[model samples]
Target chain A: AQSVAQPEDQVNVAEGNPLTVKCTYSVSGNPYLFWYVQYPNRGLQFLLKYITGDNLVKGSYGFEAEFNKSQTSFHLKKPSALVSDSALYFCAVRDIRYTGGFKTIFGAGTRLFVKA
Target chain B: GAGVSQSPSNKVTEKGKDVELRCDPISGHTALYWYRQSLGQGLEFLIYFQGNSAPDKSGLPSDRFSAERTGGSVSTLTIQRTQQEDSAVYLCASSLPGSYGYTFGSGTRLTVV
Candidate 1:
């Protein structure tokens, strides 16, 4: 079974500092990795996805993710954090070889707090 | 619609009653999905539907939970005998065939008292 893990329950960072939310995944074959953001009482918004051909993928609102195949990690990163960036982050994975369907497995989620 | 649309942004029902949530996917989207989001628990996959194919109901929690997609555009998720544990936001997402990302709606906040 394909699964994704977000080791951090919450990550606190200072405004203007770099921020990173870690994610890792396990799958039988190549994995399709995605990052999503959720604001208070809002549905998830897609951040970025690593389908193929690129190790680093940039997404909406100055967010980017680095896909590390060796470590099975796709960590969400931002060069400088802002107060508005504080929200819940989720890492999801989809196995390319899965015959069932295109159902993505999401991690438990990591709450990000950027203090000003 | 420009994006996925879900009806009844908020819903409150008495326990043991039935509730239905609706979703309208983006125009031309070939796939639609239903997920549940609780306070702490992450998004839980509920069901999936593709153009005219048999929906993957594997993620449904119980027999009382059922869903139907009409004309491959609009979908309805019905939860019979709603319980307090079912109080959570139900989200709907849609994507084009083989698309890498999904566009999600604002979601319907269902509260079962």
Candidate 2:
């Protein structure tokens, strides 16, 4: 089974400072990772995805994630934070080797609070 | 549609009653997915519909939960004898073939009282 884990339930960062939201995963085969953001009263928005290439994946809103094969982690990062960046973040994983079908599993989510 | 759209942005239903949530995936999107967002369970995948193939019901919690996509465009998720635990936001998303990023709707907030 493919699963994702967001270790931090919440992360607080000051405006203009760097922010990092951690994510780890476990999959039977190669993992196709992705990040998503959800604002209050809205559905999730796609941030970025790591399909096959590039350990460092850049996403919407100046967000980027580094995929560490050894660590089985894809941590989302931003060079500078804005108060508007506050939202819930989710990490999802899809096992590319799964012959059965394509199913993406999501993490519990981490709440991001960017204080200005 | 320019984006995925879900109907009944907010829904309040009596416990034990049946409720149906609808989703209109993005036009030309070949893959549609249903997910439930709740405080306890977080975001859980309910079902996945790709083209004309059989829908994946593995994520559906129980028999009380059922969903159908008509003409490969509009989808409706039906929950019979709803429980309080079923109260949460139901989100719908769609993706093009071989596309990793999915566009999501605003979601329908279902409240069972």
Among these predictions, the greatest lDDT belongs to: 1
- Cα lDDT, model 2, residue B99: 79
TM, every model = 0.97, 0.96
Worst 10 residues of 1 chain A by lDDT: A94-103
Tens digit per residue, CA lDDT, model 1, B29-106: 988999998888888999989888899898899998999999989999999999999999999999888787889999
| Native contacts recovered, each model | 0.49, 0.56
Per-residue lDDT tens digits for candidate 2, residues B1-113, read 89999989999999999999999999998789999989745589999998988888888999999999999899999999999999999999998887777888999999999
The deviation in Å at residue B59 for candidate 1 is 0.7
Runs in model 1 lying further than 4 Å from the true structure:
A97-101
Which 10-residue window in model 2 chain B sums to the lowest lDDT? B35-44
lDDT of 1 at A116: 100
Model 2 clash count equals 0
